[model samples]
Target: MPQADFYILPSADEDSRYQFLGKLATRAISAGHWLYIHTDSEHLAERISERLWQSSPESFLANSLPTEKLHAPILIGWQPDHIPNTPDMLVNLSTIFPSQTVEFSRIAEIVIQSDEILALTRGRFKEYQGAGIQPRMHDMRKRSS
Candidate 1:
């Protein structure tokens, strides 16, 4: 089973979620881990692609869409099957969890202050525990404040 990490953010908005992803992707890439950002839709994937590029003004994050060539270090897509199986890290940005999470060595699940997202994240945490994987929780608000 892959190690699961839940990132609880202070705000319950999509922008905050994307910001969290950008930082997480930067850290994972710096650690030499290929990142796969699985979004809920193609539009969301495109938005994330833009965010990744502008994530760091001084440094660029190599990223590409699913249909593009697989030369980038990070991939953004709505379909997990379309992503290469060799990625070391998986960042799920959607409310629905992917079934192929075990393929990656580490999975980051972001949670916000919204009730709906919070409820979904709680269920995902339980699912991970039921699968015998002990997931770690990180409250970003606590760390930032």
Candidate 2:
């Protein structure tokens, strides 16, 4: 079976990472697909599991998946672990247990749902390194020079 995993990221329209994960869980359960989410926050995990997955967080773990399908760990730009300390499990799973999941965030949907906001966010993200990282070289030059 194909492994399912993702770092659950907001599309830039949403503000909370938890919210992003919450929505993802909801969608996954709605689709009858299961996934395991790794995070340090137990409470947040529980609430999302209840609200979205409609199952216990443990169910999310039932049937583990290879992480590669997770694509690159979509670490939030700047929350706390912004330095990027991916664990060995995530790296190893990615190579073999490829996950075909999309870390849907409200931000991403917002960008697509609203045309005006989409334009503005695109401009902002272009400057950003990833999600919240500093602007890229061109944007930096545009600002400095």
Candidate 3:
């Protein structure tokens, strides 16, 4: 069974989500896990790609889009079907649950403080629990302070 992690951010903004994602991706890669970041759109995918590149001065996360040979440790794409067959982790930034939910060993859902996002994430958590997977929640707001 795949485990789900919900990162609850304080602000109702995308910037915090992106920053946390960068940190999470770096940690996942350091732990030797190949990850795929499922974005809400192509523009978001591009933004994540850029953010990952400049995540930190010493840390380096190899990421690529769907095209032009995607053999990197991390991948960023809007469509779930575009992801390769062997990613160990899936970072979901979209509102909808991924179609290929069971394909990855672990999943991360970044949740902001917006009402819509909170509601969607709650549904996703219940869905995961219904599927017999235990979902963990991390309140990033408390950790940030």
Give all candidate RMSDs, comma-separated: 1.4, 14.0, 1.5
* C-alpha lDDT of candidate 2 relative to the true structure: 0.32
The order by descending TM-score is 1, 3, 2
lDDT of 2 at 131: 36
TM-score of each: 0.92, 0.25, 0.92
Q: Residues 33-79, candidate 3, lDDT per residue (tens digit)?
A: 88988878998888889888888888667789996485788888888
Which of the two, 1 or 3, has more lDDT? 3
Specify the highest-TM-score model's number.
1
Q: Please give the lDDT score for candidate 3.
A: 0.85
Candidate 2 Cα outliers beyond 4 Å, as residue runs:
1-15, 41-145
Query: lDDT of all the models against the reference?
Result: 0.84, 0.32, 0.85
- Clashing residue pairs found in predicted model 1: none
Q: For residues 1-145, what per-residue lDDT tens digits would candidate 1 score against the true structure?
A: 6888999999988799888887888888889889888888999888889888888768767799978875888988898576666757888877776777777889899888999988988888887787777999998898875
Clashing pairs in 3: none
- Scored against the true structure, residue 47 in model 3 reaches a CA lDDT of 81
What's model 1's overall lDDT?
Answer: 0.84
Which parts of model 1 are misplaced by more than 4 Å? none
Q: Which scores higher on TM-score, 1 or 3?
A: 1
Assess the local accuracy of residue 82 in candidate 1 as a C-alpha lDDT between 0 and 100. 62
